[model samples]
Target: MGKRILVVDDEKLIVKGIRFSLEQEGMEVDCAYDGEEALMYAKENEYDLILLDVMLPKHDGFEVCQTIREYSDVPIIMLTAKGDDMDKILGLEYGADDYITKPFNILEVKARMKAIMRRMNKREQTKEEKTLVKGDMTIDRDSRRVFIAEKEMNLTAKEFDLLELLAANPNKVYSRENLLNLVWGYEYPGDARTVDVHIRRLREKIEKNPSEPKYVHTKWGVGYYFRG
Candidate 1:
């Protein structure tokens, strides 16, 4: 079956354009005009990805993204106004996997979305059926799930991907640029700070103390590495 996607935006023209573009790729597309509607569609169906605009009629994209993080790890890409750097960072903090600035070319949008989808699909297919246990934390590669003392961790797609990569190669320090290229895909145009944001969030979810993390550690000038 073709990939399922949800495209949300208050502007009907933008939504229509994106929907048409995605359909051309033979993917299934669903549309939502506001945050409330977007949340409802997200809860009702399983989508391979979501394209959400930062501005909406109700709740806003940040709130919608944060709320959805409660139960789903479905990849989300935020659409932010051009020059709004804060919007991009805020979207990541709110659990969006990626973002596209306004005035973006349709081709760039498709390339970015396709890159994320392809990377996720490739990883899901290539991962081996095995589990890694470290200090009460369990990582099941087969299920792409993480647990602490047997309680499942509600991780976003990028968070899980970062953690799994670090855990799989303990003690190997990966630079921020390296991680961005590796986990976010080489086509991603995000800066190194994106890696920092994800690492901080991952530590908060999986660490006993975010300030002095046990599982993920920073190497001062170099980058981050997993201790387990």
Candidate 2:
């Protein structure tokens, strides 16, 4: 079966052009012209990737991306006409995997999509490993599930990725930048604070004492590591 993709844009010509290009590559493409319609289609269907435009009539891409992150971790690539760095930062802040400026080459779009999908496929394969145990914690990568002391723990997509990385390589220190790149993808334009937020949240969910973490430990001025 061909890969499925959703292309969201207000410009009919742009959407048509993208759809045609992807279709030539044997991809099944879906189109949404506005933010509300995009959200509706997203909720009702399962898509491998979402190409979303930043400017729209109803809700705008940022709002759509934020709302969707509340429910799904499907890869999203934000499309923008503005050349502002902050817009790119905000897209990553809202859980987007990547962003592209407007007037982009169609070939580049196809290339970027292929690269992101490859990373996602590699990640899914990594998740096929057998369960990992750390003290009272159990991480089942196949199902993307985590349990502490026999009780299942709820975690967002980013939170799970952060924990999985640290736990998989116990005692190995990872700087904020490292975590940001490995977990959120290299195209993400976030800072150290982003990693801090996810780490703090993960500790709260897994540690019996968030103030003094047992499994995840801060390495003074270096970074963070997981106790094996």
Candidate 3:
């Protein structure tokens, strides 16, 4: 079977269009029309990616993203009607990996999906002898697990990926766009706040004091990095 994807949106036309287009690429497609159904479908099965609509009924995309982040880190690309950057920021803040504004071209959607899928597939390639340490925090690239102060910390896949990138290259600052491209390795419309949110979450889990992070540190007007 080809890559599997879940498309969530209230608009039947949009859902049908995406499903059809993705299926043509030989991808297995699952869909839901509302937020509740989306969440249910998400909880029931694992997919390579999720295309979630931001303005969904019942829980909305932000709510569903936040809830799903509690357990799953399947890459999520948000669909939003508003072109506002703030809305895009909010989606990313809620854990979406990417975003597309409404009235989008089918080809554009396909390109974004392919980009993210390519990165995912590339990362799936196994590597040996890569482990990073930042003070009390330890990261295992092979296991994709993190330990802080000798206690394991549960991290979503993307969060772990972000931490791995920074912790592995301590002292090398990364701008939001740089992190988005290198870490996500895709063209995402979401802004820098996405990186900020993940960093905050990581600090909250690994730092003794999130406000004064001893590991992940901001570079004033630049971006973020890690320190021993």
Candidate 4:
């Protein structure tokens, strides 16, 4: 089945270009011009991915992303202004799977989208139907869901991937750069801080106290590991 994607932006020209490029790839594309309309589309359809602009009328991309996250873990990539580091970080904090700066090449955008979908597909194809139990947390590999103390936790796509990797490995430490390559894809053009933000968010969700995390641990100068 061809991937279904929703492209949200205030700029009609940008949306037109992206929709054209993605449609040429044989994927189904839906376009929305503002955050409210984007949210409406998201609630009604199941999309493989979403390309959301940071600046939009009504709620804006960050708000839209956060609202969708309340019910879905669909992969979302934010489009931010060039050199806007805050926008990128904010996007991740709000549950975005990734981000691309403005003035981006359509080729690069396609590559990023494909990479995320590829990883998701590989995971679904290869993982066995089993659960990983560590302390109070439970990871359902087959369904890509995590639960703590029997209550289901809301984890984003990247968060689930990162947690599954670490929980499966026990105490194996992974450097920020190594994790970025492994979890986000080797071709991903992101800094180590991206890993940091995801880690913090994961810790907040699963840990009893995020300030002193029990499941995900920092290795001081090295990186992070899951203490099974």
Q: lDDT tens string, model 3, 88-149?
A: 87877677878889889999998988888787777676444477766677788877889987
Q: lDDT of all predictions, in order shown? A: 0.86, 0.88, 0.84, 0.88
Weakest ten-residue segment in model 1 by summed lDDT: 183-192
How many Å off is the CA of 162 in candidate 4? 2.7
Ten-residue segment with the worst summed lDDT in candidate 4?
Answer: 182-191
Looking at model 4, residue 3 earns an lDDT score of: 95
Question: Could you tell me how far off, in angstroms, the CA of residue 15 lies in candidate 4 after the best superposition?
Answer: 1.5
lDDT of 1 by residue, 53-105 (tens): 99899889999999888878787889988566766767876778788889789
Q: Candidate 2: which stretches are off by over 4 Å?
A: 187-190
Question: Which pairs of residues have clashing backbones in candidate 3?
Answer: none
Show model 4 residue runs off by greater than 4 Å: 154-158, 186-190, 209-212
C-alpha root-mean-square deviation, candidate 3 = 2.4
Candidate 2 residue pairs in backbone clash: none
RMSD of each: 2.3, 2.3, 2.4, 2.4
